[model samples]
Target: MQPWETRLEEFIAQQYGLSFDTLTKAIGKGPRAASKLAQRLKKTGRAEVARVDCGSPGPWRNSANFDDPGEVPHGPLWIFSERPIAWGYLEFDPGEWRPKASTTAHLTAVTELRLALTGLDTDPRVWTSERLLRRRLKSETGRVEVHIHDAWVRDFTDADKVWAVEVELSRKFGEGRLARALSAALDAADRSELAGVLYFVRGAGLRRAVEVAATRLAHQRDVDHLPNLEIHDLDITLAQKGMRS
Candidate 1:
């Protein structure tokens, strides 16, 4: 493990009440590095290292719980950011196995995009899941409740153009379900003058599904009349290109 990563692991373990294994998993480190870092921390007597026993039965045990599917918790506990504008949680089956670290990383990517969008503009408009729903849906027929783990929106008032932006990360459903969400967003954009949609995916399979959705949206003749769609593969990092005005 890199020196900084090891140090970070130690710090998170001490500060955030996360176990060594949990810290390593949360930070997306390999087993070798994770073990090395944990050992170093133990040697320093800064924190204790213990193995996590996954004796649970569900598919989502170790990772954050976002897929309760019953009552979504409301607060800053789910949201993780330096300056958070959106809230999200890791999705997994209850009483099942824990989710992979990559799943949480995918969630972070969507959160990063939401933060980036907020930095791009400084509008007083608040971003929330409810607001996004109202701004993105028009007719009741096209309205389908999106499993929104996290979301944020900012209203831009340039030349009387109001744009509501939202980012979502989901893993339970397939491409068809995402298509339905896109349709709802499109309908909402038509009514409220939305700017675009930024959809982030964690796995390659989901990435392909999102790509297919993007292609369909791009080819749709009516899309030009609605909000634009931007698809982001969270597994990859963005290239630091020149700044845009």
Candidate 2:
């Protein structure tokens, strides 16, 4: 296998999957170069790369506005092939499909994913976006439980400094959901080497709600051992970072 092919496989294996734009950035190449490499790897017959179609049609209007070419029917993300590759990695079989994502939710997730990519430009650590993060965390937890966070990031400077990132669009959390989220945070913090949990919410109302809920839970002596919870307004922060431009 070629060196770029091996790097592509490692990148996909680490992040689970990534869009063409992010892949380009991760590999320090232009879109055309990255696309060609992806194509060549698939053509090798030794790689098992699969495209994940982003089927949302609105809420962001132009799905391809963000560095995606208009060629692909649905803006797609590529994951390493499920079959084993030239590197002698074991076969990776994907599981049953989950329910479809709503246009709004999917768009919001894509925005968050882009913001995560922006972070990679400066941060030396690695980022595991959404579904991949869920899958990896599930496996880490014995494959019997589900993770609730949107992403998990590790600081390159400190391998022990791991952060669980959650991007909330507009879901109203009741007491039950809040309790479960808190419990999940506490359990993960206690059992793992997590440094903190970060919540990137869409609005001030949601941010305040999360802050209040997490604060209340943290104040409880029983749950005081949870990781530090930090909340930020997603849209405002993204704008401040000039990512929207």
- In order, the Cα lDDT scores of the candidates are 0.42, 0.55
- Give the alpha carbon lDDT tens digit for every residue of 1-245 in model 2: 76655655654543445555556655767777777766666576644444444564322223232235654444354435433441233233444332223333443454345444444332224665554555456665457365555566775577768777766777565655865675576557556567777667777777777777776776675676345677777777766765444
C-alpha TM-score for every candidate: 0.38, 0.60
Kindly list the per-residue Cα lDDT of model 1 for residues 90-161, writing each as its tens digit.
Answer: 111112122244344343343344333442222235444332343343356755454332443544455344
| lDDT of candidate model 2 versus the reference | 0.55
Q: 33, model 1: CA deviation in Å?
A: 25
Q: Once superposed on the true structure, which residue ranges of model 2 sit more than 4 Å away at CA?
A: 1-5, 46-79, 86-142, 146-161, 167-172, 203-205, 219-227, 233-244
Clashing residue pairs, backbone N/CA/C < 3 A, model 2 = 48-81, 49-81
Clashes of 1: 11
Report the C-alpha displacement of residue 168, candidate 2, in angstroms: 3.7
Which of the numbered candidates is closest to the native, going by highest lDDT? 2
Superposition TM-score, candidate 1 onto the true structure:
0.38
Top candidate on TM-score is 2
